[model samples]
Target: MGNITKRGSRELEGDGAPSLVEGPRTELHTELYAAIMREDCTAIQVLLSSHPINQPVTILANSTSHRFLSTQTQSIMPIHLAAKYCKAQSLLCLLEHGADPEIRDSRGLTTLHLMLLHWPISSTMWTKLGNRTQRTLTNTQKDAVRCLLILCEHGAHVNARVDDSNKYSPLHLAVAHGTSPVLSILAQKGAQVNATNESSMTPLHMAAELLNQEMTEMLIACGANVNCAVSCTGSTALKLAVCTASSKAGRLLAAGVSCIHSLLTHGATVNAQDHEGQTAIHEACFGGREAIINLLLEYEANVNILTRNGESPIYMYLQHSSNLRDRVLLTKLLYCSYPLRLTNNQGALPAGIMLPEFHLLRETLIKLSQKLLSLEDICKRVISNIYGEKHKHHLKQLLPVKMWNSIYCHDSAYLLK
Candidate 1:
């Protein structure tokens, strides 16, 4: 009922007020944009089917008060407006009236890509932080989920990559946002499970790096490649899980074990090296997670695998040998066939890298590195390597479920020959 104002299409009146041009078609374009944003579905139906303006017409991005865009989008269409504001019924009306589902904004984001950027991160955080407000968001989440399904069902491309520097796919956004429901919808729509960003990292790699066990397993079940190398770094999902837990203090202690087990069972190449040639075991030792180290060994991880600098996992462990809160892990790595003559490219042996302040501690580790494993240690290592390498996925099938933890993933390292 009031005078509509669109940027480019508007002209200044004599009193210095900006107002819409007095043309029939331009007026119709202005009305259509407003109707879609307010979700006036009936009004939108009448405007589109009867107006002289084109159904796929767009307005300037600044026309709205809330801008969800990162960079400037030259122009955004009715579908973009409806999606950004979450006007589901209005969006469906426009789509039914022949709106282009795949039309992209100047930033090259389709309707689906644009909507996910504004996803309910607060809702996900509440659930993670154990707040009671998540129940209140249930109906709202259902609406958002339905919006995504409607977009996908109307032919929005699930694998369409953003034309920005990040080059994120819908799957990448879903994982980064940590919403499994939205991720599941995209996957069901045939989103590429292994789609890479500009960094060459897959959704599975992101899941692993985030240390989300449920997401990691979901991607694996959806056929994510567990062994896929990351962007330029050549780090796989197994290494990512351990590396992220490296130094977050005790908050992240053993947090990656569940994700590591999922990756291993789904076929993670345990000994696969990064660009620097460090294996998951090398990282696990550096992080000082005995549980993760033991889990890797259960999968026949080669502790002696060298880095590009020729450093072994034992050398990495001694970096904190004196500060070790528990000696059981250091002892386990020693018994797991750590090479006695270990040396990096610099010709420094594993025991030589210990902190200088702990001279007595360094000498003790140097002596221990050269000693033979006790019979109990030897038998444990041999049986663990054999069972894990041969029957990785059937841990419960071959042993008592109770002993599974003690033998393969715990400090006990118990095993049978």
Candidate 2:
């Protein structure tokens, strides 16, 4: 007992937590890991009291499961395991017993990374969509925050990339998991707001992809570049928001709209194109959400712009039969005045792909396409294309209030009237 006491006291004599030292992957390390997985704090204390604290505990990396999912890997320390499983008491016990928070697993994820990875979600609120158990997330969130503070206080690198391959910082993890409080804490502690992941995507891109307005605004306030392009697709945050909005449930439409508005108000280019020459309007049309399409148009998104594949917004709208019932959106696109006879890469005309049920819509578009343009329609198209980039102050003076409000409000009815 005396020898064990002396060893325990001696292990804590360093300036901080002990550094990881290479050692045998013995059964003793396995027993220690089993104790951690079981959250057996007493056994953990005994294991540390009996053996050296810095000996390596080898766990296999499971990177092949999925690119987005992280698995426990070799080089993981006891503190990382405890944090990952949300065993706060065991984690505290390990920390007090000299486990280092700065130690990284084989993938270079720190204790901080593991904490964010396993942070609790509000099962009662947002869990209906998943299999998360119904439990109050209040205590779980508090515990997560406590662990985060402990790691930071013990010199965990907040901005450290999780792995050399992905370059995902702790902030990126927080954003990906939708942990807002942890995100704020990381931002307050100087996590790089514009730090890019392997795809050259900033945290703002993730927030926009999730269509989370609150997270998007927070990242913007933290100075995340609203218009940063992903190197792989050359997609900006605004373009990502539109693409993401198309796939979400209809109940989340308002949140998607709010996110788009936030990106636009932050000076995101409404007409910004991706590598394929598709704008946010193109994504909105493809998504088939009437509200988002209206919102993008209200922001003066150019509807007539063609993709590299030669698909215009009108062509994109007609390509998706799901959008057939959205008469207002169809009307808006028909009025945008692009030549409908142009062929896409598939050689499909804007009018060629119409379903049988959309006969009335097809008739209306044909009549409008053939009718001579009114003086007002000609002025509207010219203003939309020519003065699209002019400052609002000049446009406010140049155009009549009704016409200006119709364009700015995306009121297709008023504009068409």
Candidate 3:
């Protein structure tokens, strides 16, 4: 319960100085501010003992100290400033003096939020530089996770929402910022793995969006919802994996396809459509992912299922030349046991619109059409055989007899002869 003391406008008062209406304007406070700025722990300790203030001094951007701290500006506290400036000693001092770790700035960010935001650079350095550099920093300084642990010890809420964005908890921020160490701490502290933001996107979604396959797998291992749909686009993490097309996408796709396998095994609907009426097949098709398409088909994806716009996965493939192989693959998959025909709702077949480059495909469709016509002629012959000459004559009357006679006979009288 130390009290801050002020002397005259120019000098500091003694420890037992009379209470003034306002706090200290002493050179001691100024020196403390400078000490905090320069990370001079020794000077800060001496100044704190002399003025004996229970509350830590707040520093503005210009490096001036305010005796009375205000949370009105941006909800920033002294510890937040210290964390932002990477002054570990000053941060510890403020924490020791009963600094509110959860005090949010105008942005609704607590000291913990600030710490997490600034923590990644340290972790990234460790990740890139190896254990020797990590030991060097750990021996001489606190790393990001250590800082997070300090904040947690000071009662910073591990799951507090960051500002009004409501997009990230400390865990989300840690993962988003690539602070692997901080992410582990947050996860261990019971941050929700499936926690979502305004976009209904879990941390896994964020990780997938960034193509952080490692983080994505970690989140999934921690029970992140693999099929959680983003609010904006209703895209699941698997869909995102197919869509990103980055190296991260490759990793996520590997993991996500496995998840998809499990989900399908456990009875998650493969044909489940999103808001746009697009299923996983649609996503694979739109993304032009030949491998993913094959995977989905292996799992019995309904190839002919139409999207909201009446476009089947094959239609989607045909729209983009980038997806030609996928289109052809889907077409083959759809027509493997059946004839190759692109029929609309009215049963009208897509004939002239055959894939221009697929010569074999065009020939197959033509042969199938001719085979169907021949089958109809055979059915007519069987009926004629059953009903005799009178029925045959009636059937011949219905036929395009003139054209048929010209093709089969040298003259109309030749058939009679």
Candidate 4:
């Protein structure tokens, strides 16, 4: 074995059982990792200079063998390590030294993928950095972006799918993680905006799920499929927006409306239903958004359309809402000016079903029934006035006496009395 040196200063362990300098090599890699994490480039250079490039130190896992033996034994390359630690300058240094961007650990994630996967950290840290410090990218983000750019420039497959999990691509990761900077870089590098994972979800679906309005708009601008349904459940980005129970539903709804306009302009069907036979109207109703429901109706959504379970928008609202004021408002909006006797597939009229907390709705139905009866009485009176007493007698036999008395009684209000 060759003689070992510390900081290239003194030769040690000539006739050695184990070289005394071996301890320094182990300590050097650890120091390098620490320096990278702290963004201390100078300390990293000093550490790197102390060791020969071919001297094979177990920098990552501290194993004596340089070659990985087991799947768990595989150590991340320095660039992979830098990306994992969010050390941009260290990543750049490794990339500069020709570290493999395509290196995969036990998880098979590329350095870029790892950076994208660790996105929440980037978002939280960068947001704080952006707010507290300069408006420019933080030290951490600058390093991350630089690493990502290097990978992209080196043909790192901007649209590479993550290992065997087709649920995410690099674009999906970017959008899902809220890594806007990384997303921009990938988009500019020709990543497919409408690419579906195993779930058949485009990047837009991820942005909608995260309720990231800015990311949704960015993906839309890049031509993501607004109405593309995920194969897992056949949910579109708009449908997913309303499905979430989060308070961001309002913002998501607004985004969905914008996406709907774009989709409709591009020939998307407003009444398109999912695998469960639930339309965007069904989603809006379940979400209890009167504004969203109105928007869908204005787009000519089939308001009375039923799901596979035989529930219409009104039924969905009744099932999902416990508030009386909301039920009353929704009932009036859905049933006003429409005939209730229109039978659905199950032979039940839309207005006949008793909704919970909607006593006002039941009262409204009774009122409508009375109005129909009054119209019949007026038709009979008109016949008596124009045709003759004989025709009036014939009409009187056809009409129910109770209905007639209720309409024409002028004194005592006999039914009430």
Cα-based lDDT for every prediction: 0.72, 0.73, 0.58, 0.59
Query: Order of candidates by TM-score, top first?
Result: 1, 2, 4, 3
TM-score to true structure, per model: 0.76, 0.70, 0.61, 0.65
Tens-digit per-residue lDDT, 1-417, candidate 4:
122235322222232223333455555655655566666767766776775422333442223332322122223456666777667677766666556677666676777788787743444454444564543335556766776776777657787778866657899888776787666678889999899888778888877766566687778777777778888788777667656522235666576656554444544466778898888777776666666665565556665576786666665654443423454455443332222222335855444335545556556644653444355544543433343322444556776886555423324222111
Query: Which of the numbered candidates is closest to the native, going by highest lDDT?
Result: 2
Best by TM-score: 1
**Residue 370 local lDDT, model 4:** 48
lDDT of 1: 0.72
Candidate 3 regions off by >4 Å? 1-30, 33-76, 85-89, 122-142, 231-233, 246-272, 295-302, 325-417
**Whole-model lDDT, candidate 3?**
0.58
| TM-score for predicted model 1 compared with the true structure | 0.76
lDDT head-to-head 2 vs 4, winner: 2
Q: List the residue pairs that clash in candidate 4.
A: 88-143
lDDT of 1 by residue, 252-306 (tens): 5555677778888889998999999999988888777677777787788887688
Off by over 4 Å in 2: 1-49, 56-76, 85-98, 106-108, 122-137, 164-167, 338-342, 345-348, 351-376, 383-417
> Which model is ahead, 1 or 3, in terms of TM-score?
1
Ranking of candidates on lDDT, top first: 2, 1, 4, 3
Candidate 4, residue 225: how far the Cα is off, in Å: 1.6
